[model samples]
Target: MESVVLDEIDLSLIHALTIDGRAPFSRIAAVLGVSDQTVARRYRRLRRADVIRVVGRLDARRLGHVVWALRLRVAPGSANAVARALAKRPDTSYVQLASGGTEVLCGTEASSEHDHAQLLEQLTETRPVLAISAQCVLHVFRGGPAAWPALTTALDPGQAARLDPYPGVAPSEVVLDDGDRALLDALSVDGRAAHATIAHATGWHESTVRRRIDALRSAGALFVDVDIDERLLGVHANTLLLMSVAPAALSSVGEALAEHEQVAFAGATTGATNLVASLMCADVYALYDYLTDRLAAIPAISSIETVPIVRTIKRGSIFGG
Candidate 1:
């Protein structure tokens, strides 16, 4: 890894985009008090460095899908191989090699009982995979751009309002039609893609494209996530926290962790350890402080296990779609 310098302006730009990934450069410039060209230049620099990406994703729950986190003990020297294979699958996301490169951790989504069974069967039958444990994510407390407090804090209320996309009401049991799927496929590739471009791809009028996008957003069927390389944010440590909490206090502890700025995401899961959290910190010392001061305050927590992620093989997405 090489040293990267990010000034306050860069941070502000990132924060603004996290609020709205497709925000106009002029809008961002006005908020940050910089020229649009400067913001554009900085965006290009960051993109070239692979330090950040803006991606659109379908809400798994709305799509009738359930998410699973898998912990795998792989055969020696087979960890990277197995990880790459898993990464190539559209269902798996956030694949990483951990635990001395012999353990693989990743998330995948299953739409049905058959889908879930096939996934388990595929991995268990694989020769390189020795043991596996899969935890079904029951509910997401906080995740995606909406939960990144550090980025949002750079702007005051007024500035944030200027960049806000003003998404609409959440929908219940909103199933995806073919047109919806086509539109989502376009967005999954590039969250910031122009309306005209998406229209061309989906064979719909630009106005229709915009309308569908707004509808999906309002219905809570989609989200725009700005994926920043935490390393570039001076946060070099990303750890998975598996926690066991008293069943009665599960919601309390999970909600508390979700509010912590250091927490990238937290969820309640099905397993012996019912709560799972992904945390990012400036360094090991910062992570220790978070665990001791913030996490220790949660009296319901009975146990915690931490694992450092060595590499991100694939961002959770559909298998090679």
Candidate 2:
């Protein structure tokens, strides 16, 4: 695919969508000081070019699902096949070939005990699999529903405020039904889908669809996220940092990493490494600087293992093109 050259308007539009993926074009236009037609056209062009995609994702924690980060070491020359197979599973997301094509890293959401056991069984039985490690996400300091600051910085505070729709507190004891599942299926494909379109897919009235979605968002069970090609933002290097931190300073270190612009995702997990973070940089040199400078400044880190991602096969349950 050819690269899409983005100007200020394009960048601002992306920022606006990141703030509220389902925000009406007219509302975005008002904040951007452009016509509704211009905003719509720009979005269409970007979507067609695969520059940006809006997807609705269910919050596993809010839904009482367990999220696991998996690292699989495979025999030489089997990384791509292993990664692709993992990506095909509905429960897996963020599947990537990393560590010089010797390992596969991915995240999976298990909704039940059976699902969790099944995943482990499948991984253990897969041929050529040398080793496997699974980490249960204990706490998420950032990532998931949180938008990365790299694209969000294009909009000033005032503009961002105008585009932001206040998210109300989650209701206690939320649950999902068949209708909700159907609605989410449609939204996972196009978060910006019109109410009528979603209604058609879910066999619900448009008003019901709207109310259900609003309720889900309010309960923090559903969130809309913007997925873009990082290369378009000049991100040439992606690495995962697995660090063993002092247990006493784990929260502090994870919070500090979340504040870094280069850090896309940071969290605390149960594994050999207590802290795991994903970094996106302009180049390998920038990554090295972050490692030796910013990261080294933190005294809590006892050990660091850098895994450079070779290819990302999936993102947030959606396969990458």
CA lDDT for candidate 2: 0.85
Residues 57-147 of candidate 2 have per-residue lDDT tens digits of 8877788888888899999999999988887876776798886778999998888879988989989999978999998887887787777
lDDT on C-alpha atoms for all candidate structures: 0.81, 0.85
TM-score of each: 0.91, 0.94
How much does candidate 2 score in TM-score?
0.94
Root-mean-square deviation of every model:
2.7, 2.4
Off by over 4 Å in 2: 167-173, 317-321
- Tens digit per residue, CA lDDT, model 1, 1-81: 335688888888888887788788998999899999999999988888877777787678877788888999999999999
